[model samples]
Target: MAQKIIGMLGGMSWKSSAEYYRLVNEGVRDRLGGLHSAQCLMWSFDFDDIAVLQREDRWNDAADLMVEAAQRLERGGADFLIICTNTMHKAYDRLRAAVDLPLLHIADPTAERIKADGHKRVGLLGTAFTMEQDFYKGRLADLHGLDVIVPDATDRATVHRIIYDELVQGKVEAASRDAYRAVIGRLVAAGAEAIILGCTEIMLLVGPEDSPVPLYDTTGLHAAAAVELALG
Candidate 1:
C-alpha cells in the first residue's frame, strides 16, 4: 500500500501553518533517511475570518470553519487530520464531531511526553483563551495529573497581545521575545520544571535558549508525531 496521506487543517495565522509544513516534512526525512515527507493534504483559511471568530469567542462557528476544511481534505483523499493551532484546539471536540477523519490531539501527545519524562509540574504559555479556559486546563490536570501553571493576569494579557497582534502578524520583535522570557522565568521560579509552549507560533519567537528550565516545543513535537503516524 502507498503511504497514508496526512491532512493539515490550518490557517490559524498561516504563519504557524508554515511551520507545521516545514517540520512535518523535515521530521519525515530524518526518520526515513531520504527526501521522504509525509504526504499531506492542506487547506488554509484567510486568517481574518479565524481571527474575528476567535476575538469574538464564536467557538462553534470557528469549529464549523475547521470542520468544513477537514471535510474538504477528506474529499481530497486525506487519511487523518490535524488542526495546527493550539488555540484552535479549543474547538476540537466540535470539529471532530462534524468531520469523519481522526482528529489528532496535540495536547495529549505533548502531555504524554511530560508524563513519560516524569515531569510532575509544568507551566503553560499560550493565548489567554488556552490558559484561562477550561478546555485545555481540565485536560492537563484531570486527564494527566500533570499540574499546570500559568502567568499572572497582567502577564497573561501581555502574552495574549504579543501572540495575536505581533507574532501572528509576522513581526517577531526582540522586545516581545524578552517579554516571554520574563514570563518563562517567573513560571520556573514558581516551581515549573518544564514549560509547555502551548502556542505553535511561540517556538518561532522563543526557543530553548529563552528558558533556563526544560522547554517543550509543542509545535515541533506535534508535527514530529504526525510525521510518525503518516510514515507508519
Candidate 2:
C-alpha cells in the first residue's frame, strides 16, 4: 500500500498539538522505520479564535471553521483529518458533514480498546464539552456498548481547572498532580476499573501511577489510532 497523508486541525492550544505532531510522526517512524514519519498537512488556528470558542461554548460555529480547514487540507492532498484537541472534537459531526475525507474519530478507538481490555465502566476526564455532551460517550455506549463514567460536579470543576489554568497555560505543578490523583482515587472507589484521561493535557498532570485504576491516556489512544489509519 502507498503511504497515507493525514491532515491535522490544530492550535486549540499548541501544547497538545505539539504532542499529536510528535506522536503521529514517531508512531509512523517506528512502524515503517528509516525516518518514515507521518506525512501531515497541518493548518493551525490562532489562539484568539480558539479562546473565544472555548469561552462561549460555540461548538457548531467552531467546528464550521474547522470544516473549512479540513476542506483546505483535502485540497492540499491530505487523505484525512485529525482534530488535534479533544475539546475541539465536540464539533466533529459538523466537520464530518462538511468534508468528504475520512476523519478517524478518537472516542471510538478508546471505547473499542476499553472493551477489548475487558473494562465495563471507565471514568472520564476532559474539558466541559466532552464530559457534558452525549456525543463521545453516546458513541461509546451505542456504537461500542461500553459503559462510561464522568466525574461529579465538584471533581469535574477541579479537573477542568487543572487542564485550563495549569496544563494548557503551561504551568505544570507537582501540587496539581496530587490534586488530580485525589480525583482519580475517588473515581476508582466509585467502581471505575479504568480511568480515561480524556483531555490530552490531563495525561501530563496525572499518569498511571496516580490512578488506582488503569489509566487510559486519550492522547496516546488517539495517536495510535491515527497511526493505524495513516500508516495502513
Candidate 3:
C-alpha cells in the first residue's frame, strides 16, 4: 500500500508537536516493521504569536493564520490535514472551510475510542478554552452520546496553569503531576468511567500509570489514527 501524505498544523506548543511526530513515526514502524516512518508534512507556527492573538481575543485573525497554514500544506501535496492541537479545533469550522484537503478532527477519533471502551461518562482536562467552550464537549455529547465532566472552577484554573506555565515549555514538575492526579480523582468521584487527557501536553505529565481511571491520551490516539489513514 502506498502511504498517503499527512499534513499537520502544529506547534500550538512545539513540545506536543514533537510527540505527534514521534508517535506517528513509531506507529508506522510498529505496523510496517523495518525502519519505516510516516510520510508527513508539517507547518509549525510561532506559538507566541497565536497566544498573543488569543489573549487579545482576535480569534478571526488567528483563524486566518491557521487557514493560511492549512492551505500551504494542501499546496504542498498533502492528502489530508490534521490540526495537532486540541484547542485550535476551536477554529475547526473555519479551518475546514479554508482548505480543500480532508481534515481529520481530533475529537472524532477520541470520541470513537471512548465509546468503544464502553465509557458513558468521561472526565476532561485541557486548556480553559477547551473546557469552557462547546467545540470539544459539545461534540462528544451532541455527536457521540458521551457524558463529559470537567474540573470545577478552582481545578480548572490549576489545569490551565500547569498546561501553559509548565508542560508546554517542557517543564514537568512532580508537584504538578500530583495535582493532576488529585483533580482526576475528583472527577472520578463525580462519575467519570475514564479520563480524557484532552490537552496534548497532559500526557507528558500524567499517563495511564498515574491515573485512577483509564487514561485516554488524545495525542497518541490522534497520531495512531493519522498513521492508519496514512498507511491505508
Q: Against the hidden reference, what TM-scores do the models get? A: 0.96, 0.95, 0.98
Better of 1 and 3 by lDDT: 3
Give the lDDT ranking, best first.
Answer: 3, 1, 2
Between candidates 1 and 3, the one scoring higher on TM-score is 3
Candidate 1 local Cα displacement, residue 22, angstroms:
0.6
lDDT by residue (tens digit), candidate 3, 1-232: 5899999999999999999999999999999999888999999999999988877888899999999999999999999999999998989999888888789989889999989988999999999989888999999899999999999999999999999899989999999999999999999999999998899999999978887789999999999999989998
lDDT of 2 at 76: 97
lDDT of each: 0.88, 0.83, 0.93
lDDT of 1 by residue, 1-232 (tens): 2567889988887899999999998887788776676689889889999889888979889888887888899899999988898988888888788778788888988998998988989999999999999798889899899899899999999999999988888889999999999999999999999999999888879988899988998888889889878877
Estimate the lDDT of model 3: 0.93
Which pairs of residues collide in model 3? none
Query: What's the CA RMSD for each of the models?
Result: 1.2, 1.3, 0.8
